[model samples]
Target: MPDHAISGWAVVLGQLAYLLSGTFPDGPLAGAALTLWMAVLGCAGATVLGVGVAVLLDQAPAPLARAIRALLAGLRAIPVLMLIFWAYFLLPMLAGVHVGEVQTVVLALALIGAAYTAQVMEAGFAAIGQGQRNAALALGMTPLQALWLVVLPRTLRAMLPSLGNVWVSLAKDTSLAYIVGVVELSTVATQVNGRSVGYAAQVFAAVALLYFFICVWIESVAALLLAATRSRQRRPLWRYVTLTAFRLARTPARPPPTSASRGSSRSRPAPP
Candidate 1:
């Protein structure tokens, strides 16, 4: 058996590094950087909007919750590509406004991500027994306080792994932005392949590995957050920030001295 000598690895590594770190000649982030920006914004928006929607749904009247649920279900059913087209094309026309390609792509991804994440969050929220929040309320906690400190913490832990998956999915979906002319990792890889000539498979494989590593890191961070959030449920920390703010606001202001008292004090001090 002959030992295979690895050849041309340096070129592959150089291309991957360039793809991951290079900026466009026009000074904008290119390749992986742009893709990362899109992913973080899309996933962050999704997490916030998804959690907010789920909370609103849980707290809403039965009929209203049902309506919201149906609406989200319908939105989630729509394909992501169509959402991109809708945002990139129809949205500007409907609103009589122009939006940048990057903004449109991120908005479309966020909307779809929010819809899917909302479903995951709703299920997590539902799994929580009401007895806990009810107990907090009985012990003088406001509904909002109980929800924030008690209900939300537990519910979030239940959903963190799932939410992490959504984040991973959102990052990969940034490739769809190519149709709208937003240059990101996958599009940039294609462009580089077209220009470089050969090593196309290797470049794409590098892109895949980058995505895989990023998703792994995201899940690891999510796991840590999940653990921290779980601990917060055991020892509620939300009140500390509010209490600190309350203490700061309660600080005593200086009182004004009366003119008569000031004159009398001056005279007495002179005698002394």
Candidate 2:
């Protein structure tokens, strides 16, 4: 039984190696390398663009906010795969410009990610208390200063968990690049399976495991951050208690006025 198990395992490993080597070569640069690079670039570009959009949405006035909301809604309603296909096919004809499949995927992902980010940030901004802004203003800070120094930091803290979730969502969304011929992990896995006909299950299983590992890592980090934030929150409770006590201690005592000072009648004073 052990020997049989070992034989089965060897076959699986051999198949995996054959699929990988056939799909991507062992060199300084290869298909796997390109796929990873594209994924990283796509993810990073999306993040930066998304943050910018969020900032814009947070600062927009009512009318502009409505317009932006409508725009984002439309974008979000469209599927990412459809967006990629449209961009891949129509962009060149419309603008007389062309880009490779990976570039097209990155652009599409960034645009979609930015729309979602803006929405998330809008919620975060709305969640902040007005008293915080008022206090900042009372402290002689300008509107922008209040936003930057007080509102932004707090909003970011509040949004970190959501942002991490969004990032995981984006990572999964990268698999959609396969539709546009961008050789990301999913695409490479598909190619491997195509070449190794009987090993599709194993190939896809391995790919899924890889994605699971990535998500687990992200979640672990998020949990650590949340724990730290909780600790910070506990610390502030003590500070608040101390501050309240100090205010109580500094309150002044007043003396009662004498009966003569209370009298308002000039006639009584003359008689005295």
Q: Return the top candidate by TM-score.
A: 1
lDDT per residue, candidate 1, 46-68, as tens digits?
Answer: 98898899888878999999999
Clashes of 1: 0
Model 1, C-alpha of 78: deviation from truth (Å): 1.2
* Stretch of 10 with least lDDT, candidate 2: 24-33
lDDT of 2 at 224: 80
Task: List TM-score per model, in order.
Answer: 0.81, 0.72
lDDT of all predictions, in order shown? Answer: 0.80, 0.70
Query: RMSD of each candidate?
Result: 8.0, 9.4
Clashing pairs in 1: none
Q: Residues 1-272, candidate 2: write the lDDT tens digits.
A: 67755554455566554333334444322233454455456657766877677777667788987887899899999998999999999999999889788788778877887787777777887899789999978866677767766676677678878877876776677778778666666766776667666655566777777677666666676678667765753644554675466556657767887677667544365653
